[model samples]
Target: MKENANSALKIVASFVFVFAIVGVLYVVYFNSNGQPSTDVPVGVKTFGSCSAMSSFIKTNAQKSYPSYWGSGVVRAFTGVTGAISASPSMAEGGKATDYSTTNIQVAGVDEADITKNDGKYIYTLSGDKVVIIDAYPAESAAVLSEIAFNSSTERVTEMFVNGDKLVLFGDKTDYNGPIMGAEISYRPYYYRTSSFVKIYDIVDRSNPILTRDVAIDGNYYSSRMIGDYVYVVLNSYVYEDIVMPNITAGGVETPVAGCADVQYFEDVVDSSYSLTTIMSINVNTEEMSEKVFLTGNTQTMYVSTDNIYLTSTQYYYEPMPLVGDFFPRSEEKTLIKRVGINGNTVEFKAEGSVPGWILNQFSMDEYNGNFRIATTSGHVSRSGGGSSNNVYVLNGSLDTIGTLEDLAPGEQIYSARFLGDRAYLVTFKKIDPLFAIDLSDPTNPNVLGKLKIPGYSSYLHPYDETHLIGIGKNAIEAEEGDFAWYQGVKLSLFDVSDVANPKEMSMVSIGERGTDSYALNDHKAFLFDKEKGLLVVPILLAEFDAEPQSDWDYGEYTFQGAYVYSVDLTSGFTYKGRITHVTDDSLLKSGYYYESPYSVKRSLYMDNTLYTISEKTVKANSLIDLSELANVSLPYEGSDYYYGYYGV
Candidate 1:
């Protein structure tokens, strides 16, 4: 449901890279004859090597800033004092029946999350540390070690596993907190931020040796891993006016002085002191490469094997730009920039714009060579009350080629999924109305069919090529009010076999009024193995005896754990019951107040064994009957770092 969701591009197929380094001002030195204009076209500039890229950044640090940064930028730095090994960087897979990896959205693409398992070990995020478990041999599963952060400012939140190497990404904060008191030269005060990136080699089960560490002056944005290369995005708010940024490599603090070749885009963004940086590093390489571009906060990102898309949203108040009006005519638009990447090399390929903001990563998908996006425009705001939705298709160059807009008025997009040539969208106001769209013709898209259901699905997954499963809330069509009160968790199976008449073949819901599941929010919590017809989701349920006698009707914790089910196109959904780590009645007595983020945040399998993970325990169950096999009590369960999963 939540992630730091996050490339390189070639300018042209045959263009050879030239390192325009020290004293080389590519922005001003070259004139627009046969070369690029002062306002370069939206494309990438390649550095022949990592050293060249660093030199370019160091050389052009002054140009990296917009006109606004010179006067009002803020700067502050922190030091990490923990011991780090200086072993030489060494580089870098395996099996089917591996119970599938992480239920990724796309086949070859890997998304960073809190937990990652390669069928042998379960690497999960616990507070500020990563706990590695020998999960394969279920009965003998044990905690190998805990990888902790270097300082109080370091928080290891997300990670991605590439073969024998584990790349952990986190943010580095200053203990001093936000800069306070009077501002110098009339500039405002803001908090300083940075990023913490570390890679480790875990060939030996018990001890994981840290191979390399890279820290930069920016907050981590998002990341994706492909093959042995990892691409991470970092965003920095240049509050302090500094000539160069404070960066670190290995254990020594370094300066981004000689090679800060920051570049700018032709399109102007109003905000100042914003730098968007993308870093690409190979697991086997000792050196890391980075490209810094200028922009505002990167709101949404979509990454594929070949391209990385960074999108930002801006609100435009029209008709009243020059004059003051009580109710201004305003609208929101999202700007999308595409970059092509190969290993550590990144290039800007194309750029485009859509009407409104996207819901999540699933809202945008590339089919064949065409980029497809879905956005919702207009809303019932103080400015106006009309609402509209759209589906836009863009070509390789990011030129809007076709559009299908003005769909399901008053209802914004609740969930969307694109499969091959078709897209399924669910929009809700009072009820969920699922729309089926055809994208066979890029220039002219059409809505083939639609169906209305009681509730909306926040997340959608393909059950098969012809069917889909939606996870969301259950609701009764508002009995007396215009809106529905969400209750429990709803699962709907949709059959899109007939493009013209898609239907919800069947559905099932669990829990009571206050019940909730992590699957409804994060896609990572939802696990599905088509080969085994198995579906698992971590759910937290609260229930009452019946309708409340008073306005404040409180419910007690009914169940907490993962739910197992069997999904089939022919028979619909068959329940396999629940799996919980709560062992005694004493824990159950605690009830409603019971809060544990690790209380089954995720579930994974190695062949036939199903492992249910909680902060305090790890329990394996038989895949056939849902019977408990062997349970292992984990350490650090008392650590306050553990919080409720649904809080975020």
Candidate 2:
């Protein structure tokens, strides 16, 4: 009986050994095939790297081997699964030029006007030069004779064309020499001595003669023409002169002479700089009329049929008070008012009373005959700044229609456009989600959908009701010797047919990293005819190179030509060529070049032309033919600064 029991035990032990051997073989085979093994379990470590080990063998030596076997196995499995789930490749297509060279001319380009007149001629303001281009046979869109102001220093601030008559508001600046003993080496303070509003008769496209030049007092900042009357906004003090006091050896304040009274314009002092007024001029009769006295600083004005909307922002300045010395306290407010143009009455008003500072710039779009205003407001603390966008839609009478809040958290709204029954708001921070709001019901609007991307978008234009062309920066990689430094602009095409689920079709980066705004012509073909459908992309190339970044200091850069592209709502979008620069030596060398006056930070697009305002030039506009200017290489050739990506 004992011998039989011993034999039974030996048989059981043999069975257990065979089972263990089989388990080991299975684990080895599973691992060899890039699959998870039961016996050899994979585990993640502190470094997030993976390691694998046999369950039966647990040893300190194995733990010290520094093997990433677990990670390798997971990666292998991921690769297999990804291969199985990959989508089919898109069909390859031929590349097409974005823009074709049609006509080139020397004119100051502003975003204010780029509308087609009589369906054949294109009117645009280029500094003191006003150009009318024929847009019929493509080649016919050449610049006719340009009207120039007699003085080389005089410049046109704003312009509008109504049928055959074109009205221009111009301002001239005279230097009062250097502020202090500093000669040409110092920045000169400019004083505007004269302002003029001129009207031109352009019945004949080739020869547009000036009809009247009405003198305007103060600085003519901006103007809009509706019917026979022209509404103008004027300001005597545009900028404040800030002077930081120097500390002496004995801890005494050393006042700098000729500093132009740094605190002269503060509200507490009630200085002359606080005064500004809005006026109206009759183009048909050539008569001047005062409309309203703008108490606060007015930045931009929009004129509709019955009302003129002005965005009024305030400014403040004060000296830092000593330990016990009285400190000057000042606060500024941003208010939007709809004033009656015919009767000169304040119709509607909405003011932001928060303690934080508000930017003077805002975007206005007309939807279903109602006006929509989108402005940014935020709180500024010592640690950081936070802001929110407030969109106010007003009725035809300038009454409040609706409000959309928190569209962008902490980002400023740059531009807004209405497409069909929806409005798209563009923001400054990263490629913001395009908030698609339904304006079908003007009073009670609904956020129908949103389009999100990975980069920043300043301006959005609709190719149709379903597709939008977002102009901004994508990603960029800088090459330094053998190494590469990468950044992104986030320039891309988005399919918004399903607004809720907008898909990023494709995105390409321009040369370096910078902000870009696009100007698109919508009447022409979406994909073909580069000369017909133009997309002007103005890249603030210099801002990418500035240091100690100042909110006000947009780098000094020229209007680096226009980048043209073609868009198709049904299929997709394509990068066309760029408008080639005028090759003629005379035109290239002419002093009448485009300079961006506004800080490079802001994107300006008016009509269908793009404008980049700079402080170096009196005229701040650049007119670009998108269809004909895309794919055209810029003349800049440097290492730190290169041409921005024209198209993606």
Report, for all candidates in order, the number of backbone clashes.
30, 45
lDDT of 2 by residue, 527-635 (tens): 1222234443533233345462432233333334334454454335456544323333333222223332121211223233332222211111223323332111111
RMSD of each: 10.7, 28.5
What lDDT score goes with residue 234 in model 1?
82
Question: CA shift at 375, candidate 1, in angstroms?
Answer: 0.4
- Model 1, residue 382: distance off in Å is 11
Task: Compose the digit string of candidate 1's lDDT tens values, residues 1-648.
Answer: 011111011111011111010111112111112122234443434334435543333343434322122233321111110000011122212221445466676666678887887777788876556888877667777788888765567888689877678888888876444345534343434456788788888888578888998888878988888888888888775454342345688678765422234444333333323456777878777457666655555667788888998776544433333244333454666678788878766767777787876777888898888889988886533233467788999998889999999988877888989888899999877789999999999999999999987889999899877899999987765455456667778999999999788899989987766777878878888888777778898877777777765423445667778999998887778999888876544443234222564468878887778888776667888889988777866664344322222221
Q: What C-alpha lDDT, on a 0 to 100 scale, does residue 90 get in candidate 1?
A: 23
Q: Tell me how candidate 1 scores on lDDT.
A: 0.67
lDDT of 1 at 423: 93
The C-alpha TM-scores of every prediction are 0.81, 0.53
